[model samples]
Target: MTNPPYGTAPGGQWPPAGSPFTSPAAGPVSSQKQSRGPVIVSLIVAVLAIAVAIGAWFRTAHSDVTTQSTTAPQQFTTQQTSDANKALCDSYHKMFRSVNGAGGQTSDDPVLQQVYAINIRLATHVASDFMYDKLRENPAGSPQLASDLRDLANAYNEVLMAQLADAPKTELDPLYSNIDSADAKLVEACK
Candidate 1:
């Protein structure tokens, strides 16, 4: 009346003493093999999904780096040019103020008038011979005109500052009228 091993069937008979279903003691001798179909398929799918994710990550990262590198250089160059142009504008403004004065007219003082005239001539020469020439040769974004203007402005500031300290009107006599003519020519060129 005792069962064969694991459990008795409804008819009170066990499958068999040596069968895998018949007893928990069965190990290597078991007849059934575990199914590996779903596990293998899952492993393959997981590997492919990971590969796709890695590839996508790398592609996007590379494109982003390339785009940033391309634009970075242009931004740097533009910023440098802008800074240089700003300096040029400042120098021009300073020179213009010194020559034209705060009163909106050239001074009546003979010495001051002569000084302004010389500065006007030097600035005119630079604007016409140097700046305009460079502008014509190199187009709108050229740095040459800005550089020359800054240089000429610096020179005028230095010389005029020295003259304002005590230098007589006659000290500038050598440059008189020649500068005026040059300025006149520059004005004409503008037209």
Candidate 2:
């Protein structure tokens, strides 16, 4: 049996006369070509967006550096530094007195003793941090005062660490001595 011709038109004609769907020879159909304009435009837009983002990032990074470099450190007057040092010394003295006062009130109960110890540690830490912050903010005009403040802060940090570790009095004595020496030097520098 023979198969019918594919795409047979009316009256059994393989190709209808002057039909637009198929060519007379019945080769491939002629379709319209897709436009590349939109695709090219989209690609250009994406590249431009990426370039703009990169440019903005570079500009922000440069401005940050520029701002940092242009900013100057705060300078303190001699009288201002002296007053700040005196205030800091007074605060430290008061804190030490309060700590000593608290130490005198002892409890027989282990729990109460532990609570007192924790409170004392917290007080000492707060006092140390306050002193450090004050020193940093005012920045003593005299180099000797600045050095002493640094030394005192370092000593206080060591004492705090020792206290946290539950170190014996023997281990902490040297750190306390360092603090006293620094404090004496700072007092002298302040005057």
Off by over 4 Å in 2: 1-76, 186-191
Positional deviation of 47 in candidate 2, in angstroms?
56
The Cα local distance difference test for each model comes to 0.45, 0.62
lDDT of 1 by residue, 144-167 (tens): 443344344334444454444656
- Indicate the TM-score of model 2: 0.49
Best candidate per TM-score, number? 2
- For residues 37-70, could you state the per-residue lDDT of candidate 2 as single tens digits? 5565566556655765675465423233224324
Residue 101, model 1, lDDT:
51
What TM-score would every model get versus the actual structure? 0.26, 0.49
The number of residue pairs in model 2 that clash at the backbone is: 0
The 10-residue segment of model 1 with minimum total lDDT is 133-142
